[model samples]
Target: MKEPAHHIILDAISQSASDIHFHPTPNEVEIHFRINGQRHLYKKIALTKYKVILAYFKYTGKLDIGESRLPQQGSLSFEENKLSYSLRISTLPANSLESLAIRILPQKDIQSLHELFLFPNQFKQVRKCLKNKSGIILLTGPTGSGKTTTLYAILKSFMEDNNYQTITLEDPVEKSFAQAVQVQINPESGLTYDEGLKAALRHDPDIIMVGEIRDQSTAEFVFRAAYTGHLVLSTLHAKDTFGTILRLLDMGIKKLELEQSLLAVASLELLPLQLRKFKNQRAAIIELLEGEILSEAINKQLSPLTAIDFQKLRRKAFAYGYISEENCF
Candidate 1:
């Protein structure tokens, strides 16, 4: 890669970009950085360097240089000092050649739940769920909402205890944990979510992590795993913790099946830290639905938290740390 393109990648990572986009124009190169959920321009580059950057991604990800007309997906792992990153690369055609978007994955040493700036009791709540012998704990959030980070933290907590065998089946296998057996799913190979779960069962895993419950079969696989005495952790794209149950229902998972196996649903939202005095760190607002309240609510199909209750929940959540008053109600 050219010096300019290489610098761009480093700069984007420094800015905490989730993804980078390169677009070629007549004389200018449009560069976009996805920070948080919004996209902002990093800077315009010369068209020549755009080609170099695109080629760099193609080579690094081992993509067919000629196959840019169709959508191509690949990944690259970069290591600098002790910091490592896995870049997810996707290339598609613009008007002529390929336009590339690269996802920036940051590797940070697993932080203790207490060090996460969570309240001591909040840490207790999280750890309590993890200590359960057999059940499903669902983490719900939109894309780029730090669900993976939270899951990883829980895995780290379990790893330190060395109490159980953990296995994870992630679509792209985002990051690695030293103690867990991680598997990557390949659609082309016909090794799907359900197939992977079936294989995991045979391995006698105490904890199983499925990246996401995308469909009915996958949802059933996860529920079955939990029923069979495995502690399951997974993420889902839902509006709130309550919505996770409805999503499973839509996935053709029966209500009774859900009532028996579901242990907890913790939903998190990422909010900008710039809105408050602290600008260096972001806050996660979590809502956990469980026990009799969650069971009754799900069985009745009743949404428990009203707008007022959300305000109260947020107030209580802030007792944890880093969460600002403005972020809640």
Candidate 2:
């Protein structure tokens, strides 16, 4: 049973799969792997064999094996051929049997800012925002859109400089950095984002990274941290730069506060690149808003001076032959 389980996970890593899905039915279990924004069927196993594999995974991942009725999450580290990988495990109760999903995080896959951005101008704009000593820079994207990866790259850049004190508040602390202090948020222990931010402030951190701004309280706390002369970087879920502003407003943040400390907004989307040019599968294209352009956006002033949006980025990608026409939509 353990041999089969290890084989499945090692196969996923070898294929550069970002996620693996195990859908169990009454008689058998179906397996699928997601790579480069596409999913493909991998294999199937008998229900009897799958049960043993599931039990082994649950126990190794430190999750309660008896809790089949409720959803659960756990994480574990795996090593194969001297390569290290982090696996985030999640199980959900299905109609007949529990379904499992694993997110494969490769420790060696970290990319620098220049490597991640599709355009040099976009990279320059982001660097300018990071240079600011005090302001809030928000990154917006959906899940699997490279938001967290971008944040990590930026944090790594700062860490290398050794000029400022950096701290991060992440839910599960995705990756490890030796230069920066990372705090994992555990609600069970009363360590919420708001509480974590307050504690981080006392350390006189020059830069703060919030894993995400998920609620009104966290949003307000981020703004407060920005106002107090610290650079705050965070991610939000929105479609575009303007949509990110609307989300903050809808979250009960005052427009005046936004106008004062908001430095820039970057909305990112990943598109599959032409296979022949690169070894990696996908790259990020960003829609950026900043400076007077951001002020105009907050004021609802539509002008030609506003920064480029996602639609424009998509058109450029299509024209440059970096992506296919069907992907432009």
Candidate 3:
């Protein structure tokens, strides 16, 4: 079918496509879309048509169309279906031509915590941390493990109950919420993560969400925001909950400050390819930290105990994903 690059993108959003891919093949060019976290073949199009789509994105989004040596980034919005997306574009070295990939961002919709199928124990801790008026809650997990969705769910809960100024500083501003203000970090305008976070604080927000805490400035600022009485919810790139402590310490946050300001850290993992069930569904197994044990561990600057040993402790609670009665004493 004949379609402009912008219109093709809008059609993908209408189909609820999560990811789009562009690649060249021996006979023809190939396009793929990841739907519901699984990759599916979309269609094969002619080489010239693919080039037009890439040029369209490069030109309209003000990307570096002339530069074949460096990567480019851009975004497109579709108002008719209330959908938006950000694209990352780059040229392949061998072909000396541009290619593209797009990540979808759906506008926010109301979804309850229970709909995610949380274990009772995990849900209780998550609910407690989110319900608190002021504190820093860290959700750590590998990429594509639903960490962002959990954060969105928490924000949705707050939006349903009362009116408060909630702001999120994300690299691409993935999802939009009705009652919250969202800002995109623009490197071209000197709006790095640190800059965006500083701007967020000046707004006197009731809640602040930092997309990812990579360094000392953001880690320290988020902690300070929590200590100063703003509810902070954000994610970290680490193996599990315990590793989150080590990561902050590595970034220059003191142990005492972390213990004082940080409310909880949750680690999650999406089961490997070997564990996926019969249906298209995938499950996230989560580990949560809280209470006195968590406090002492952070205060002491303890390295996370081994996962093998920690899983043994998890055997004690043995219900939900955390602990179960049959496996416990």
Candidate 4:
């Protein structure tokens, strides 16, 4: 049973698949793999064999094998060909069977800031934000838009230059870094975002990374950290750059507090690039709002400076022949 499961994972890795999905039907199990933001059917197995495969994954992932009524999440790491990969498992109960989804995080695929952004000017603007000594720099995007990867690249760049005491509070510490302190939040163990922030403060960190700003309490704590002379980096879910300010305001953060603590807000969207040398690659297009532009947006004042947005970036990409006209929309 385990042999077949391992073979599936190895095949997915070889094919550059980012995720694997298992859907159990009445008669058989459907398997799919996601590669380059597209899903494709990989294989199928009999319903009887799926039970053994599902049990093998649950046991190896350290999930509760007996619990089928509620959702469960677990993660495990594997090494092959001297490269590390992290598998995050999630299971949800359906009508009569459980559906499983696995997200594959490969350390080798992580790219630098220069390689991630489509425009050099955008990279320069982000670098300028990192030079700030204290303030909150928020990265806004939907899931799988490469926010975490950008944050990691920024931290890596800073660590190579200066010995800054950096700390990160993530739900499940994504990637391990030897130069910085990483904390995983386990609410079951009485360690949450708020609690983790309190504990991270005690370590006297010059820079702090909150994995996300999910609620009012976490947002307030992140603001407090920025106000107290610590450079803070975090992510939020929003549609665009302007939407990020509205989101923070909706989360009960005061306008004055945002005015004082916000250094920049970068909203990202990944677009498939049509490079002649490297086909089928993706790059990020960022709508960056910073400095006076950030202040104006937070205050509900509109100006021409706000025109530097995703629409403009998309036009630029199309003009450069990096993307097609249909992709501009």
lDDT, candidates in the order shown: 0.79, 0.87, 0.69, 0.87
CA RMSD of each candidate after superposition: 3.1, 2.2, 5.5, 2.0
Task: Report backbone clashes per prediction.
Answer: 0, 0, 5, 0
Residue pairs clashing, model 1: none
If ranked by TM-score, best first, what sequence of candidates would result?
4, 2, 1, 3
Candidate 3 pairs with clashing backbones: 317-323, 318-323, 318-324, 319-323, 319-324
Candidate 3 lDDT for residue 306:
34
lDDT of 3 at 164: 77
Supply candidate 4's per-residue lDDT for 1: 94
TM-score of each: 0.86, 0.92, 0.74, 0.93
- After superposition, candidate 2 runs with Cα above 4 Å error: 301-305
lDDT of 4 by residue, 88-164 (tens): 99999988999999989886744667888988988988888889999999999987787888888888878876789
Reference-based lDDT, residue 53, model 3: 80
Worst-scoring 10-residue span by lDDT in model 4: 300-309
lDDT for 208 (candidate 3): 89
Quality of model 2 by C-alpha lDDT: 0.87
Residue pairs whose backbone atoms clash in candidate 4: none
Q: After superposition, how far is residue 250 of candidate 4 from its true place, in Å?
A: 2.1
lDDT per residue for candidate 2 within 1-329, as digits (tens), equals 78999999989988989999999977789999988878899998998888898888888889999999999999999998888888999999999788999998887755788888887888887887888889999999987888989999988777666578999998888877767899999989999877888899899899999888888988998898897799999999988788888889999988899999999999999988874776547888898888888898888734335577677888898898888888888
In model 3, what lDDT does residue 18 have?
68
